[model samples]
Target chain A: MADGNEPRVFRIRVRGSDVVASCAETEKALIALEQAVAFPRPLPVNVGCRKGGCGACRVKVLSGDYTTIKMSRAHVTEQEEAEGYALACRIMPLSDMEIEPAFLSPRERMEMRQAQKFAD
Target chain B: MSQEGLLRPGIAQLRVLDMDEAVKHYVEYLGLEFVSKEDDGRVYLRAYDEFHRHSVVLREADQAGLDFFAFKADGQEAVDGFRKRIEDFGYTVDDVPAGEMPGTGARIGFTVASGHRIELYADMDLSEDAPETNSPMIWKTMPRGMRAQRMDHCLLYGPNIEEVEKFFTEVLDFHVPERVDMPDGAFAIWMTVSNKAHDIAFVKHDEPGKLHHLAFFLQDWNDIGHAADIMTHYDISRDLGPTRHGITRGQTIYFFDPSGNRNEVFSGGYTAYKDHPTRVWDHNSVGRGIFYYERQLNDAFLSVVT
Candidate 1:
């Protein structure tokens, strides 16, 4: 759902699902998803030690004009930067892009649910 | 069914300093709940609307690194079995009583390969039943499929790769999935028996303490971006890109904590469970080099060696 005044600028594809929006940056894209689309479930954000030091909030920028902000070199290697990857916490999308979340799987989710049931 | 070799341990509790800071970070940032706090500056935190006493423990300490802790074992027999295996290697084992900590039950003690003190025990009286609160932010705006299962694994920086690897594989029964080699013929290994690529990874650090980073698994890709947005709102510095590793094909992002410890959240690691007698590669083999991308050295990594 694009606001009439907002220009139809770029598109973002998440996990093979294409999402079109007028938002220009990655942050805006996420906000748009929250407002415009119905997600299957609630997402978890553990932005622990937000200083890019914690790596807990990392996301991959598959395609976009994104740049990181003051990321520590020790945390990410030089080889990692060139391969079209940017930290979601530090990355600000300058253009339309696609990004992927790391480490989420259906089987893992089932295990978690089972763990919760056992705990209960 | 027999539960012979199952790692059915849940997080007993993480002990950290500064209850207020820990609470604010884990609860507000990570979406965990402050189940309870004590006057002694210890805080217990839980995740995923769970009824367990606490998944992480934050306690007051002069230093802010990981304090002593334990993982849950299935039962008394499992603890004894694990103890026999460890003691056969000539490491001492001790028995600690429950009630010393709020959520912890009975426990057996041993040291990890990285020389960290660890406890293995079972039958800590966990709260039988608890309700799941529909917290406003719990399930909204979630990625297509998002559910944090449990504390998946921890990565440690070890100076001696062979020593640590042997300790885990031989003494603790951890399986090695992949080992990347340094150009100079040394090895950096990732080991785990769980379905995920590596429950615990060991990287060669110039120094002898925990150097690399700690990682947790997420159930959804969208949460990665959402979590990043939350970090930006807090004005924290970002460390690295969310790149896919050539070796594991696992996507990863790295950052630092207030104390400068590195943490990583990665997904989609290739599993080696089916391949029971997995092939072991040489430290200088070509296959090892594929996963890691060559990066320009920065001052931080350089400083560690210098």
Candidate 2:
């Protein structure tokens, strides 16, 4: 729902899928995604803390304008961010965007799996 | 006994996200004296007590992790001996020319079994404000932040625990003062070449080249509590602290820098001697070994690394 002055519509490209979803612009990409769609099963986004302390939820914006909150360099390097990688939980969309979530490295995937189990 | 081999944890190079924020955290808040920032964009700093030109080097970069941790060898001959031994052990050593870092001598570096860069050097120019030798006051200047005495030790996380343990002992002459044994294999080891309980340590993790924390030495328990107070006052992000490690028995507080590299300020551990038996911990009681007061491991301590 567009409230004229309150919100704007943006299109997002889900990584590894052809589906494009229309999402309401929000403070964070994750929140915007949650508002517009839901995943049938977990796609291993590996998010935690959501405040940028942990290096989870990392993604790469393929195209479009966006801004991000403060983030830990441990997760995304400035060079990598400049090259378009970002943390989805910290990124705020400013225009129509296309992003591809980075696949976790073998070690990172295992660590996330273990951490999720422990958290449960 | 002569101190003729590895002498101390002499230098640490860290990558920071923002130079301004890193300076504020390390200088004004942590109290290290800013020595100089090179034209190449690296910042050099030292504790008030250190005689070296600098002990910590900060580079502004997108990544936040250790660049390398170096030890001060007793002499040029000793450095050469270690370099030869390291090469003989199968890892190629690269020479870092003198003046690559200001006020420092040539260094030899090689990757260790656990995927961390370890370096050794034998010379450094004494700082302009080094502790006075004659009629010296308790300190040349008043301490700030937690009044850190020295950059003490670092805990690293990576794979191949057995090989790393063997490399430190067989190649570097570091003796283990404490260790944790997991069911699968050796989970962790605290090693030292000097008298301090642990000069460096490592934990078993899948990731290579991950930093657990960089610790600095504080005076005593009072200083540890004061550090906690300072953390509260400045609103620094804290992980855990003002607790004791059942292994080294050091009083400690673990916090984070703006870039998310964990930092610890601790005091009071039993003096380590080569003759002392290595203290061992079983996986079941390992939580107590890491945090004596809590007696339970926190999730962050186990998983968080930069």
Candidate 3:
């Protein structure tokens, strides 16, 4: 069990880069990433509306146990969500997570999903 | 003062993720008077200067955003008239029972074209702790935190702004005081039913029912600076300003509530006369229009909404 006083750090994998986050940080993953960016390291993904409306901080939760808050359904379709799409601003990671920015067009997303299946 | 039609921002019900944190932010930091927390855990609050029982309601929800903003009509007749006009304008208006909100009278609500739930009401029980009227003293209690005078206006983001303009202007007697013309057609409009520069504003966005910010009136530029101090001393998340807006010419500081909903405490915008021509801002100059000193739109302004 993670101690409330000493929250366990979770590694957030964004593409090839990694940013360290902790349960003690903000509940929103993008805000943790934003904190990382304050170290002057450029954030890997575009972020907007850190409250979950803009969908600019959306990413594919390639692997993770996380909780999702309500998001703009228009930006993330139910099908896309089932395929692991989640807005970073609405994602509260419960474990170390692997993610990729998912701002690609539908065809590109489809291609990436298929390639992932092929790798699987 | 406009004797009829929608008057000013009466009450705004905001959705908060944590009621305790939100109450602290709104009451302690923003300086609104805490009223009562209802059985449903919705908290009621009001500014020191307001005469009504309360003007703000915070409800704990899974999501944080505006639930609805209501305007106070002059009387029950004005409320009925607007309901008729709103219904006639092709949107369904429904009654929100008087007791639904504590001390508030019956409200006529409709989903505006901008996808915001806008309501109009006419009556509210007078506040027990209302500002002194006998000798018209400053206040019954010393103003705290940022000293918010009232819930002044809100800026909403959604699509179909052109239709929204027609809805308010034609039906509610609101007129455009300031507007921005992006290269991609209508972008933003500051509309008012009263003399204040804008009673509410709407900006075009793909999302529906997004609250850009709810503004509370401050005293003046010095108070704006003081508000900035409170925000910094308390480590509040600020989006922009202790600066002026070229559009409304108000001193403003945009910050976030604990739930990430944007809030503004501002003062000093020119009174928008009925005959005044609509001030226009082109896309190129909107940065200055929004933030007079920065001369650029912050990333947060265009993107962040709750």
- List, residue by residue over A14-47, the lDDT tens digit for candidate 2: 6676556565566677655554546544433543
**Which residues of candidate 2, in runs, are more than 4 Å off?**
A1-67, A70-106, A109-120
Candidate 1 local Cα displacement, residue A87, angstroms:
24
lDDT of 1 by residue, B178-206 (tens): 77665664457777645567766666654
After superposing candidate 3 on the true structure, give the runs of residues whose Cα lies further than 4 Å from its correct spot.
A1-13, A16-42, A45-99, A102-120
lDDT of 3 by residue, B132-160 (tens): 88879887889999999899999999889
The residue-by-residue lDDT of candidate 2 on B157-246, one tens digit each, is 988978888888898899999999988889999999998999999998888888899999999999999999998898676777789999
Model 1 misplaced stretches (Cα beyond 4 Å): A1-120, B1-3, B6-9, B12-17, B49-51, B125-149, B183-186, B209-211, B274-306
**Candidate 3 colliding pairs:** none
User: Which clashing pairs does model 2 show?
Assistant: A78-B62
- The candidate, 1 or 2, that scores higher on TM-score is 2
Q: For each candidate, how many residue pairs have backbone atoms clashing (under 3 Å)?
A: 32, 1, 0
- How well does candidate 2 match the true structure, expressed as C-alpha RMSD? 7.6
RMSD of each candidate relative to the true structure: 14.8, 7.6, 5.4
Instruction: Indicate the residue-level lDDT of B163 in model 3.
Output: 98
Q: Regarding DockQ, does 2 or 3 come out ahead?
A: 3
Candidate 3: tens digits of C-alpha lDDT, residues A60-99: 9888778787775535667778888988878887788889
Q: Sort the predicted structures by DockQ, highest score first.
A: 3, 2, 1
